[model samples]
Target: MLCVVYKSPNKEGAYLYLERRDDFRQVPTALLDTFGKPQLITVLNLAKREHLAQIDIHKLQAALKTQGFYLQLPPPPENLLAQHKASLQNDKG
Candidate 1:
């Protein structure tokens, strides 16, 4: 089992992606503190595979909170200017 952490492109929040033996799961980033950079902690519960299988947003939040983390949803990705231009040209044509 492996847990990966990533910061959002907008720098607003982060995300955690978990890889297990047979599946993958995503959890919202956690805001731990007010000072310094917010650290996102991802714990791979090797023994709780069964529980994780039925994990919901609230349960995920609670699990993170137990480790002194807070849930934070990251901002959506911004559209690139070039991509936008191309999309507009395609629509016009």
Candidate 2:
């Protein structure tokens, strides 16, 4: 299926995918407010690809079919303090 991709300037690396271009009927108003103005990124054909850079192709397609839209948030920031605590525990062990 062909899907439209949009990126929000408010949050870096965050993307919103829609089943059709400029279609946001399925997307919630609160989400749209937080997502900010969506800048068109690209239109992708899922059937023509095996994988996506950061998303699972199967899950994306499923979401598009069921929910009509998919939100792609950036990975959480690394927690240095949590890592340090884990390392200290390992050292004690």
Candidate 3:
């Protein structure tokens, strides 16, 4: 299923990952403005690092508001494999 992933605009806006494509399509421009792009990037990195299936946008936003940072989800399995291959090559060098 396709999902809508976006950043919130409010102060320390958190990353939002909507399961429904419609929700993603419906994101208000004003909301995006409130959540700065940088903050959204941070959240995306976190979700990617942690390997989260579905992150709670509201919780992430709240954490960002209070802590200024959040844990990243782990990289996807494919990415992990690629990283491992790169590391092996580097070690050979």
**Tens-digit per-residue lDDT, 1-93, candidate 1:** 333343344345544433332122233223223222424445565444544443364555455445423234555677799789999999999
For candidate 2, lDDT tens digit of each residue in 34-64?
A: 9999999999988899999999999999999
Best by lDDT: 2
Q: After superposition, how far is residue 2 of candidate 2 from its true place, in Å?
A: 0.6
In model 2, the worst 10-residue window by lDDT is 39-48
TM-score, one value per model: 0.26, 0.94, 0.26
lDDT of candidate 3 over 1-93, digit per residue (tens) = 223355544443255554433233334566545545523232144344433455565565554555433333434446788899999999999
Q: Is candidate 1 or candidate 2 better by lDDT?
A: 2
Task: Estimate the lDDT of model 3.
Answer: 0.47
Give lDDT: candidate 2, residue 17.
99
**Model 1 stretches with alpha carbons more than 4 Å out:** 1-62, 65-68, 71-73, 80-83
